[model samples]
Target: MGTYETAATLDFVVDAVPGLSSTTLGWILVILAAAFEFLGVIGLKKYSEHKTLFNGFIYLLGFGGAFAWLYFSFEYLQVSVAYAVWIGIGTAGAVIINMLFFGESKSVGRIASVLLIVIGVVGLKFVS
Candidate 1:
C-alpha cells in the first residue's frame, strides 16, 4: 500500500477504538516514545563510530519520533510525570541492553539502581 493509504488506515483504526481514554493513549504514546529513545541512543552510538549519513539519518529519525510521541503523551499525562517516566524507561532499557549485549558491568549496584528506576516509574504511574 501507498504511504498515504497506510497512514489513513492507521488513523481510521485509531479513531475507531471505542471509548479509549486520553490517559491510556498517553501512556501508550509515552511507552512507545521511550522505546524510540532507546533506538535513538543506539543509533547515536553507531553514528558516532561510523559518521555515516545513513546512521545519522537513523539517529535523527529515532530522536524525532521519540520527542513527537512524548509530546503527544502530554495530552493525557502530567508533563513532569510523563517526562520522568520516559527518561526512566529509556535509561533502564539502555542499561539492560548494554549489560546484555556489550558485556557492560552487571554489578549488584547497577542492577539495583535499574530496579529502583523501574519501581519509581511504576509508582509514579500508580500515583498519577
Candidate 2:
C-alpha cells in the first residue's frame, strides 16, 4: 500500500480502538512494539540460520505486530519522538537480550553503551 493508504488505515485502527490515544495506552503500545521489534530481530536471525518457512512466518508476525502497535501509538505521541524512543528501546533490548540469552558480549563498554541508550530513551520520553 501507498503511504497515504497506510496512514489512513492506521487512522482507522486508532479510531476504532477507543482510549488507545490516551497517554498510557500510547506508551504501552510503544513498549509492546519495542518487544515485538526484538522478537522480529530474533526471528530474522533464526531465519538466516535455518531458512525455514516457520521462521520466516514468525519474523513477519513479529515485524507486522511491531509496526501496527507503533503506528497506533503515534495517535497520541509525536511520531518523531515516539519513533526514536521505540527504536532506542528495540536496539537496547535486543542487545541486552542477546547478551543475556544468546551469550553475546558482556564487556563493560558494551553494557555502558546500552545504559546510555536507555538513558537517551528516558530523556526523549521526558522531553516529549
Candidate 3:
C-alpha cells in the first residue's frame, strides 16, 4: 500500500481501539521497537559467540522489525521526538538486558546511568 493508505489504515486501527489515539499508538510502537532492539542485541551477542544461521536470523528479524515499527511511529509523531525516544529506550533496554542475562556489570553506577536515560526520555515526553 501507499504511504497515504497505510497512514489511513493506521488511523482507523487506532480509532477502533478504545481510548487509543494516534499519539498513544505511536508511543506503543516506540516501545515495541525497543523490545525488538533487545532481541537484536541478544542475537548479536549470540552470533558473536557462535556463527549460526538461527542467530543471524534473529539478528536480522529483530533489527528489521524494530526499524519498521519505528518508521510507523513517525507517522504519528515528530521525527526528532520519535527517534530520541527510540534510542533512549533501546539503549537502556540493551544495558539492562546485558546486565541481567549476559553477566555484564550490575553496578549501582550503571543502574543510575540507565535511570538517567529514562529520566531524559520522560522529560522529552513532557516537553513535547
Candidate 3 local Cα displacement, residue 75, angstroms: 0.4
lDDT of 2 by residue, 10-114 (tens): 455456787665666678889999989988988887898899999998888889999989998887688999999999999998898889877899999999999
lDDT against the true structure, each candidate: 0.85, 0.85, 0.90
What does each candidate score in C-alpha RMSD? 6.8, 3.9, 2.7
What lDDT is reached at residue 8 by model 2? Answer: 24
Q: Can you rank all candidates by TM-score, best first?
A: 3, 1, 2
For candidate 1, what is the lDDT? 0.85
Ranking by lDDT: 3, 2, 1
Q: What tens-digit string does per-residue lDDT give for candidate 3 at 6-70?
A: 54236877878998988999888889999898889999999999989999989989999899889
* Weakest ten-residue segment in model 1 by summed lDDT: 4-13
The true-versus-predicted C-alpha distance at residue 31 of model 3, in Å, is 0.7
- Candidate 1 local lDDT, 1-84, one digit each (tens): 656421211233347789776678788889999988888877887898899999998899889999988987776789999999
Pairwise TM-score winner, candidates 2 and 3: 3
Clashes of 1: 0
Please identify model 1 stretches exceeding 4 Å from their true place: 1-15
Candidate whose lDDT is highest: 3
